[model samples]
Target: MNIGFSAKTKAFYDLDEKAVYIQNASWSEDVKSISEVLWLNHCGQPPKGKIRGADEHGMPCWIDAPEPTEQERIAEAVNIRNAMLMTADTEIRQLKIIEEICALTSEETQRLMSWKKYLADVYRIEPGNVSSIRWPDVPV
Candidate 1:
Protein backbone atom coordinates (compact mmCIF):
# COMPACT_ATOMS: atom_id res chain seq x y z
CA MET A 1 0.00 0.00 0.00
CA ASN A 2 1.18 3.49 -0.88
CA ILE A 3 -0.09 6.70 0.64
CA GLY A 4 -0.44 10.12 -0.99
CA PHE A 5 -1.78 13.48 0.11
CA SER A 6 -3.65 16.36 -1.51
CA ALA A 7 -4.65 19.77 -0.20
CA LYS A 8 -8.04 18.64 1.13
CA THR A 9 -7.87 14.85 0.93
CA LYS A 10 -5.58 11.85 1.39
CA ALA A 11 -5.41 8.69 -0.66
CA PHE A 12 -4.26 5.10 -0.17
CA TYR A 13 -3.82 2.61 -2.96
CA ASP A 14 -3.44 -1.15 -3.07
CA LEU A 15 -2.15 -1.82 -6.55
CA ASP A 16 -2.40 -5.57 -6.25
CA GLU A 17 -6.13 -5.31 -5.53
CA LYS A 18 -6.67 -2.53 -8.07
CA ALA A 19 -8.42 -0.46 -5.40
CA VAL A 20 -7.95 2.93 -3.79
CA TYR A 21 -9.26 4.53 -0.62
CA ILE A 22 -9.82 8.23 -0.19
CA GLN A 23 -10.94 10.38 2.73
CA ASN A 24 -11.27 14.10 3.41
CA ALA A 25 -8.76 15.46 5.94
CA SER A 26 -11.39 16.00 8.62
CA TRP A 27 -12.86 12.51 8.18
CA SER A 28 -9.46 10.82 8.04
CA GLU A 29 -8.52 12.31 11.41
CA ASP A 30 -11.42 10.47 13.07
CA VAL A 31 -11.40 7.45 10.76
CA LYS A 32 -11.14 4.97 13.62
CA SER A 33 -14.73 5.73 14.66
CA ILE A 34 -16.24 5.69 11.18
CA SER A 35 -18.14 2.59 10.10
CA GLU A 36 -18.55 3.36 6.42
CA VAL A 37 -15.88 2.53 3.89
CA LEU A 38 -14.65 4.86 1.12
CA TRP A 39 -13.42 2.66 -1.60
CA LEU A 40 -13.02 2.89 -5.39
CA ASN A 41 -11.60 0.62 -8.06
CA HIS A 42 -9.65 1.27 -11.24
CA CYS A 43 -12.08 -0.41 -13.62
CA GLY A 44 -15.38 0.77 -12.16
CA GLN A 45 -17.13 3.87 -13.53
CA PRO A 46 -17.59 7.03 -11.49
CA PRO A 47 -20.78 6.84 -9.42
CA LYS A 48 -23.75 9.20 -9.84
CA GLY A 49 -22.66 12.66 -8.68
CA LYS A 50 -18.95 12.19 -9.19
CA ILE A 51 -16.59 12.82 -12.07
CA ARG A 52 -13.22 11.14 -12.61
CA GLY A 53 -9.61 12.19 -12.11
CA ALA A 54 -6.24 10.54 -11.75
CA ASP A 55 -5.62 8.69 -8.49
CA GLU A 56 -2.43 7.96 -6.56
CA HIS A 57 -1.72 4.92 -8.66
CA GLY A 58 -2.35 6.82 -11.91
CA MET A 59 -5.75 5.13 -12.03
CA PRO A 60 -9.17 6.76 -11.85
CA CYS A 61 -10.50 8.63 -8.85
CA TRP A 62 -14.11 9.72 -8.43
CA ILE A 63 -14.28 13.43 -7.70
CA ASP A 64 -17.08 15.79 -6.72
CA ALA A 65 -19.69 17.08 -9.15
CA PRO A 66 -18.80 19.58 -11.85
CA GLU A 67 -19.57 23.31 -11.85
CA PRO A 68 -22.92 24.84 -12.77
CA THR A 69 -23.98 25.85 -16.27
CA GLU A 70 -22.53 28.90 -18.05
CA GLN A 71 -25.62 31.04 -17.40
CA GLU A 72 -25.73 30.14 -13.72
CA ARG A 73 -22.02 30.82 -13.46
CA ILE A 74 -22.35 34.27 -15.04
CA ALA A 75 -25.31 35.15 -12.79
CA GLU A 76 -23.40 34.12 -9.67
CA ALA A 77 -20.39 36.15 -10.74
CA VAL A 78 -22.56 39.22 -11.36
CA ASN A 79 -24.25 38.87 -7.96
CA ILE A 80 -20.91 38.60 -6.14
CA ARG A 81 -19.47 41.52 -8.07
CA ASN A 82 -22.47 43.69 -7.21
CA ALA A 83 -22.15 42.89 -3.50
CA MET A 84 -18.43 43.63 -3.55
CA LEU A 85 -18.98 46.95 -5.34
CA MET A 86 -21.62 47.98 -2.80
CA THR A 87 -19.38 47.17 0.13
CA ALA A 88 -16.47 49.04 -1.45
CA ASP A 89 -18.61 52.07 -2.14
CA THR A 90 -19.81 52.18 1.45
CA GLU A 91 -16.26 51.95 2.79
CA ILE A 92 -15.02 54.63 0.42
CA ARG A 93 -17.74 56.99 1.57
CA GLN A 94 -16.99 56.36 5.25
CA LEU A 95 -13.30 56.84 4.67
CA LYS A 96 -13.90 60.09 2.80
CA ILE A 97 -15.95 61.50 5.67
CA ILE A 98 -13.41 60.43 8.28
CA GLU A 99 -10.60 61.95 6.27
CA GLU A 100 -12.17 65.43 6.55
CA ILE A 101 -11.47 65.55 10.33
CA CYS A 102 -8.14 63.71 10.49
CA ALA A 103 -5.40 62.65 8.10
CA LEU A 104 -5.83 59.16 6.64
CA THR A 105 -3.46 56.86 4.86
CA SER A 106 -3.90 56.68 1.11
CA GLU A 107 -3.84 52.89 1.38
CA GLU A 108 -6.92 52.84 3.59
CA THR A 109 -8.75 55.56 1.66
CA GLN A 110 -7.96 54.16 -1.78
CA ARG A 111 -8.29 50.45 -1.10
CA LEU A 112 -11.68 50.14 -2.73
CA MET A 113 -11.27 53.02 -5.18
CA SER A 114 -9.97 50.73 -7.89
CA TRP A 115 -12.43 47.93 -7.24
CA LYS A 116 -14.30 48.59 -10.46
CA LYS A 117 -11.16 48.20 -12.52
CA TYR A 118 -10.28 45.02 -10.68
CA LEU A 119 -13.73 43.48 -11.13
CA ALA A 120 -13.64 44.48 -14.77
CA ASP A 121 -10.28 42.76 -15.22
CA VAL A 122 -11.33 39.65 -13.33
CA TYR A 123 -14.72 39.25 -15.03
CA ARG A 124 -13.49 40.31 -18.49
CA ILE A 125 -16.02 43.12 -18.63
CA GLU A 126 -15.52 46.74 -19.61
CA PRO A 127 -14.86 49.00 -16.62
CA GLY A 128 -17.96 51.02 -17.57
CA ASN A 129 -20.12 48.01 -16.74
CA VAL A 130 -19.37 48.39 -13.00
CA SER A 131 -21.66 51.31 -12.31
CA SER A 132 -21.65 52.50 -8.73
CA ILE A 133 -24.85 52.70 -6.65
CA ARG A 134 -24.20 56.33 -5.59
CA TRP A 135 -20.42 56.82 -5.65
CA PRO A 136 -20.25 59.50 -8.33
CA ASP A 137 -16.71 60.47 -7.27
CA VAL A 138 -15.42 56.96 -7.98
CA PRO A 139 -15.91 56.76 -11.75
CA VAL A 140 -16.03 53.48 -13.61
Candidate 2:
Protein backbone atom coordinates (compact mmCIF):
# COMPACT_ATOMS: atom_id res chain seq x y z
CA MET A 1 0.00 0.00 0.00
CA ASN A 2 1.26 3.45 -0.89
CA ILE A 3 1.57 5.96 1.95
CA GLY A 4 0.61 9.60 1.59
CA PHE A 5 0.48 12.67 3.81
CA SER A 6 -1.90 15.61 3.83
CA ALA A 7 -0.22 18.80 4.87
CA LYS A 8 -3.58 20.48 5.30
CA THR A 9 -4.78 17.84 7.77
CA LYS A 10 -1.31 16.95 9.03
CA ALA A 11 -2.16 13.26 8.72
CA PHE A 12 -0.81 10.17 7.00
CA TYR A 13 -2.75 7.78 4.84
CA ASP A 14 -2.63 4.73 2.60
CA LEU A 15 -2.79 6.34 -0.83
CA ASP A 16 -3.64 3.22 -2.82
CA GLU A 17 -6.89 2.70 -0.89
CA LYS A 18 -7.48 6.44 -0.35
CA ALA A 19 -7.89 5.95 3.40
CA VAL A 20 -6.27 7.45 6.45
CA TYR A 21 -3.85 4.96 8.06
CA ILE A 22 -2.27 6.90 10.88
CA GLN A 23 -3.47 9.55 13.25
CA ASN A 24 -7.11 10.64 13.42
CA ALA A 25 -7.51 11.76 9.82
CA SER A 26 -10.17 12.02 7.16
CA TRP A 27 -9.89 12.12 3.38
CA SER A 28 -8.61 15.58 2.52
CA GLU A 29 -8.38 17.25 -0.85
CA ASP A 30 -4.74 18.22 -0.20
CA VAL A 31 -3.53 14.63 0.27
CA LYS A 32 -0.26 14.14 -1.58
CA SER A 33 1.10 10.70 -2.29
CA ILE A 34 4.55 10.48 -0.72
CA SER A 35 7.17 8.35 -2.44
CA GLU A 36 7.28 4.88 -0.89
CA VAL A 37 11.07 4.96 -1.13
CA LEU A 38 11.20 8.29 0.68
CA TRP A 39 8.81 7.00 3.37
CA LEU A 40 10.94 3.91 3.84
CA ASN A 41 14.06 6.08 3.88
CA HIS A 42 12.51 8.00 6.75
CA CYS A 43 11.96 4.65 8.54
CA GLY A 44 8.15 4.86 8.46
CA GLN A 45 6.69 5.21 11.95
CA PRO A 46 8.83 6.51 14.79
CA PRO A 47 10.05 4.07 17.45
CA LYS A 48 8.15 3.70 20.70
CA GLY A 49 8.50 6.70 23.06
CA LYS A 50 9.24 8.89 20.08
CA ILE A 51 7.13 11.10 17.84
CA ARG A 52 6.78 11.66 14.12
CA GLY A 53 7.94 15.06 12.93
CA ALA A 54 9.44 16.72 9.86
CA ASP A 55 13.04 16.89 8.77
CA GLU A 56 14.92 19.96 7.51
CA HIS A 57 13.41 19.31 4.07
CA GLY A 58 9.95 19.11 5.63
CA MET A 59 9.78 15.39 4.98
CA PRO A 60 8.18 13.08 7.55
CA CYS A 61 10.69 12.01 10.20
CA TRP A 62 11.10 10.61 13.66
CA ILE A 63 11.94 12.63 16.76
CA ASP A 64 12.83 11.57 20.26
CA ALA A 65 10.04 11.75 22.82
CA PRO A 66 10.68 13.84 25.90
CA GLU A 67 12.18 11.86 28.77
CA PRO A 68 10.30 11.82 32.05
CA THR A 69 12.00 13.46 35.01
CA GLU A 70 13.00 11.55 38.12
CA GLN A 71 9.88 12.64 39.99
CA GLU A 72 7.66 11.58 37.11
CA ARG A 73 9.37 8.21 36.96
CA ILE A 74 8.87 7.75 40.67
CA ALA A 75 5.19 8.61 40.38
CA GLU A 76 4.78 6.21 37.53
CA ALA A 77 6.45 3.46 39.53
CA VAL A 78 4.18 4.07 42.49
CA ASN A 79 1.12 3.98 40.24
CA ILE A 80 2.17 0.67 38.75
CA ARG A 81 2.97 -0.84 42.15
CA ASN A 82 -0.37 0.34 43.55
CA ALA A 83 -2.20 -1.27 40.65
CA MET A 84 -0.42 -4.56 41.34
CA LEU A 85 -1.28 -4.30 45.03
CA MET A 86 -4.96 -3.69 44.25
CA THR A 87 -5.17 -6.98 42.36
CA ALA A 88 -4.15 -8.91 45.49
CA ASP A 89 -6.28 -7.02 47.99
CA THR A 90 -9.38 -9.19 47.85
CA GLU A 91 -7.47 -12.46 47.97
CA ILE A 92 -5.32 -11.32 50.85
CA ARG A 93 -8.32 -10.14 52.85
CA GLN A 94 -10.17 -13.40 52.29
CA LEU A 95 -7.17 -15.41 53.43
CA LYS A 96 -6.80 -13.28 56.55
CA ILE A 97 -10.47 -13.77 57.39
CA ILE A 98 -10.11 -17.51 56.96
CA GLU A 99 -7.07 -17.54 59.22
CA GLU A 100 -8.92 -15.62 61.95
CA ILE A 101 -11.95 -17.97 61.91
CA CYS A 102 -10.24 -21.35 61.83
CA ALA A 103 -7.01 -23.23 61.21
CA LEU A 104 -5.84 -23.00 57.57
CA THR A 105 -4.87 -26.11 55.63
CA SER A 106 -1.26 -26.55 54.59
CA GLU A 107 -2.08 -25.41 51.07
CA GLU A 108 -3.89 -22.31 52.35
CA THR A 109 -1.01 -21.50 54.67
CA GLN A 110 1.46 -21.74 51.79
CA ARG A 111 -0.68 -19.56 49.59
CA LEU A 112 -1.01 -16.91 52.30
CA MET A 113 2.75 -16.92 52.85
CA SER A 114 3.41 -16.56 49.14
CA TRP A 115 0.98 -13.68 48.86
CA LYS A 116 2.49 -11.95 51.86
CA LYS A 117 5.97 -12.25 50.44
CA TYR A 118 4.76 -10.97 47.12
CA LEU A 119 3.26 -7.92 48.81
CA ALA A 120 6.47 -7.29 50.69
CA ASP A 121 8.51 -7.59 47.54
CA VAL A 122 6.24 -5.15 45.77
CA TYR A 123 6.43 -2.71 48.68
CA ARG A 124 10.21 -2.89 48.79
CA ILE A 125 10.48 -1.95 45.12
CA GLU A 126 12.16 1.46 44.86
CA PRO A 127 10.83 4.17 42.62
CA GLY A 128 12.59 6.13 39.80
CA ASN A 129 14.12 2.95 38.33
CA VAL A 130 10.97 1.36 36.99
CA SER A 131 12.52 0.13 33.78
CA SER A 132 14.80 -2.34 35.58
CA ILE A 133 12.40 -3.22 38.38
CA ARG A 134 11.49 -6.89 38.46
CA TRP A 135 7.83 -7.28 39.26
CA PRO A 136 6.87 -10.04 41.65
CA ASP A 137 4.89 -12.90 40.16
CA VAL A 138 1.17 -12.94 40.76
CA PRO A 139 -0.22 -15.80 42.77
CA VAL A 140 -1.81 -18.48 40.69
Candidate 3:
Protein backbone atom coordinates (compact mmCIF):
# COMPACT_ATOMS: atom_id res chain seq x y z
CA MET A 1 0.00 0.00 0.00
CA ASN A 2 2.92 2.32 -0.69
CA ILE A 3 1.67 5.33 -2.60
CA GLY A 4 4.05 7.87 -4.16
CA PHE A 5 3.00 11.40 -4.92
CA SER A 6 4.86 13.63 -7.36
CA ALA A 7 4.16 17.00 -9.00
CA LYS A 8 7.74 17.74 -10.10
CA THR A 9 9.35 15.56 -12.75
CA LYS A 10 12.56 15.74 -14.77
CA ALA A 11 12.47 13.85 -18.08
CA PHE A 12 15.57 11.65 -18.24
CA TYR A 13 15.31 10.74 -21.90
CA ASP A 14 13.72 13.74 -23.60
CA LEU A 15 15.33 17.13 -23.00
CA ASP A 16 15.76 18.84 -26.37
CA GLU A 17 12.04 19.35 -27.19
CA LYS A 18 10.54 20.50 -23.90
CA ALA A 19 12.63 23.66 -24.22
CA VAL A 20 10.93 24.49 -27.51
CA TYR A 21 7.41 23.79 -26.19
CA ILE A 22 8.00 25.80 -23.03
CA GLN A 23 9.42 28.66 -25.11
CA ASN A 24 6.13 28.77 -26.98
CA ALA A 25 4.05 28.39 -23.81
CA SER A 26 1.76 31.28 -24.83
CA TRP A 27 0.96 29.52 -28.15
CA SER A 28 0.54 25.97 -26.73
CA GLU A 29 -0.11 25.47 -23.03
CA ASP A 30 -1.11 21.82 -22.74
CA VAL A 31 0.52 20.17 -19.71
CA LYS A 32 2.47 17.08 -20.79
CA SER A 33 0.65 13.72 -20.76
CA ILE A 34 2.44 10.35 -20.36
CA SER A 35 2.26 9.60 -24.08
CA GLU A 36 3.44 13.13 -24.97
CA VAL A 37 6.33 12.86 -22.50
CA LEU A 38 7.41 9.56 -24.09
CA TRP A 39 6.83 10.94 -27.60
CA LEU A 40 9.23 13.70 -26.56
CA ASN A 41 11.77 11.41 -24.90
CA HIS A 42 15.58 11.83 -24.92
CA CYS A 43 16.35 10.81 -28.50
CA GLY A 44 14.28 13.79 -29.68
CA GLN A 45 11.53 11.70 -31.37
CA PRO A 46 8.51 9.54 -30.54
CA PRO A 47 8.89 5.78 -30.05
CA LYS A 48 7.92 3.23 -32.75
CA GLY A 49 4.74 1.68 -31.18
CA LYS A 50 3.74 4.98 -29.47
CA ILE A 51 2.46 3.26 -26.29
CA ARG A 52 4.41 -0.03 -26.14
CA GLY A 53 7.70 1.97 -25.69
CA ALA A 54 11.40 1.94 -26.54
CA ASP A 55 14.56 0.15 -25.45
CA GLU A 56 16.98 2.93 -24.60
CA HIS A 57 20.60 1.69 -24.29
CA GLY A 58 19.48 -1.90 -23.49
CA MET A 59 17.13 -0.70 -20.71
CA PRO A 60 13.47 -1.72 -21.04
CA CYS A 61 12.21 1.82 -20.51
CA TRP A 62 8.49 2.38 -20.80
CA ILE A 63 6.16 5.36 -21.16
CA ASP A 64 5.51 5.75 -17.45
CA ALA A 65 2.97 8.35 -16.40
CA PRO A 66 5.67 9.76 -14.21
CA GLU A 67 8.94 7.88 -14.14
CA PRO A 68 10.22 7.09 -10.64
CA THR A 69 13.70 7.70 -9.30
CA GLU A 70 16.27 4.89 -9.14
CA GLN A 71 15.71 4.49 -5.37
CA GLU A 72 11.95 4.16 -5.81
CA ARG A 73 12.44 1.46 -8.49
CA ILE A 74 14.84 -0.42 -6.19
CA ALA A 75 12.32 -0.23 -3.31
CA GLU A 76 9.61 -1.67 -5.58
CA ALA A 77 11.87 -4.60 -6.54
CA VAL A 78 12.71 -5.27 -2.85
CA ASN A 79 9.01 -5.26 -1.96
CA ILE A 80 8.31 -7.93 -4.59
CA ARG A 81 11.26 -10.02 -3.37
CA ASN A 82 10.04 -9.88 0.25
CA ALA A 83 6.50 -10.88 -0.78
CA MET A 84 7.83 -13.95 -2.65
CA LEU A 85 9.93 -14.97 0.39
CA MET A 86 6.87 -14.71 2.67
CA THR A 87 4.95 -17.03 0.31
CA ALA A 88 7.89 -19.49 0.40
CA ASP A 89 7.88 -19.44 4.22
CA THR A 90 4.15 -20.26 4.37
CA GLU A 91 4.64 -23.17 1.87
CA ILE A 92 7.52 -24.58 3.92
CA ARG A 93 5.33 -24.56 7.08
CA GLN A 94 2.56 -26.50 5.25
CA LEU A 95 5.19 -29.00 3.95
CA LYS A 96 6.14 -29.93 7.58
CA ILE A 97 2.55 -31.15 8.08
CA ILE A 98 2.96 -33.54 5.11
CA GLU A 99 6.34 -34.72 6.45
CA GLU A 100 4.77 -35.64 9.80
CA ILE A 101 2.13 -37.72 8.00
CA CYS A 102 4.92 -39.60 6.13
CA ALA A 103 6.36 -40.97 9.44
CA LEU A 104 3.56 -43.55 9.74
CA THR A 105 3.37 -47.32 10.59
CA SER A 106 3.89 -49.97 7.87
CA GLU A 107 0.23 -51.05 8.13
CA GLU A 108 -0.84 -47.38 7.86
CA THR A 109 1.38 -46.92 4.81
CA GLN A 110 -0.10 -50.04 3.08
CA ARG A 111 -3.65 -48.94 3.86
CA LEU A 112 -3.00 -45.41 2.54
CA MET A 113 -0.99 -46.62 -0.48
CA SER A 114 -3.78 -48.98 -1.51
CA TRP A 115 -6.15 -46.00 -1.78
CA LYS A 116 -4.72 -45.32 -5.29
CA LYS A 117 -5.24 -48.96 -6.32
CA TYR A 118 -8.80 -48.74 -4.99
CA LEU A 119 -9.44 -45.67 -7.21
CA ALA A 120 -8.13 -47.42 -10.37
CA ASP A 121 -10.10 -50.56 -9.42
CA VAL A 122 -13.30 -48.47 -9.22
CA TYR A 123 -12.50 -47.07 -12.67
CA ARG A 124 -12.00 -50.68 -13.94
CA ILE A 125 -8.41 -49.77 -15.00
CA GLU A 126 -5.37 -51.80 -14.03
CA PRO A 127 -3.18 -49.89 -11.51
CA GLY A 128 0.50 -50.19 -12.42
CA ASN A 129 3.48 -49.48 -10.16
CA VAL A 130 2.62 -47.50 -7.00
CA SER A 131 5.61 -45.21 -7.53
CA SER A 132 4.58 -44.36 -11.06
CA ILE A 133 0.87 -44.06 -11.84
CA ARG A 134 -0.06 -42.66 -15.24
CA TRP A 135 -3.71 -41.71 -15.45
CA PRO A 136 -5.29 -42.73 -18.74
CA ASP A 137 -6.85 -39.84 -20.64
CA VAL A 138 -10.52 -40.01 -21.75
CA PRO A 139 -13.64 -42.02 -20.78
CA VAL A 140 -11.76 -45.27 -21.47
Question: How do these models rank on TM-score, best leading?
Answer: 2, 1, 3
Which segments of candidate 1 are over 4 A away from where they belong? 1-66, 106-140
Per-residue lDDT over 1-140 for candidate 2, one digit per residue giving the tens place of the 0 to 100 score = 67776655546767766543324445777666788886776655668887766655556766787788878888988998998787677678899999999989999999988888888888888876777899889987
Backbone N/Cα/C clashes per model: 0, 0, 3
Residue-level lDDT of model 1, residues 1-140, one tens digit each, is 32232323333333333332333223232112111143435235668888655454443357787776766655765776566666656666776777788877877545545644544444444234444322223333
The C-alpha TM-scores of every prediction are 0.34, 0.51, 0.29
Worst 10 residues of 3 by lDDT: 1-10
Ranking by lDDT: 2, 1, 3
| Residue-level lDDT tens digits of model 3 in 30-115 | 22334444343442544643333334332224454446566665566555445544544454444445548776567545544454
Pairs of residues clashing in candidate 2: none
* Candidate 3 residue pairs in clash (backbone atoms < 3 Å): 13-42, 14-41, 14-42
Candidate number with the higher lDDT (2 or 3): 2
CA shift of 14, model 3, Å: 36
Clashes of 2: 0
As a TM-score, model 2 comes out at 0.51
- What is the Cα-based lDDT of residue 52 in candidate 3? 32
Q: State how far residue 87 of model 1 sits from its true place (Å).
A: 2.4
Backbone clash pairs in model 3 (N, Cα, C under 3 Å; residues 3+ apart or in different chains), count:
3
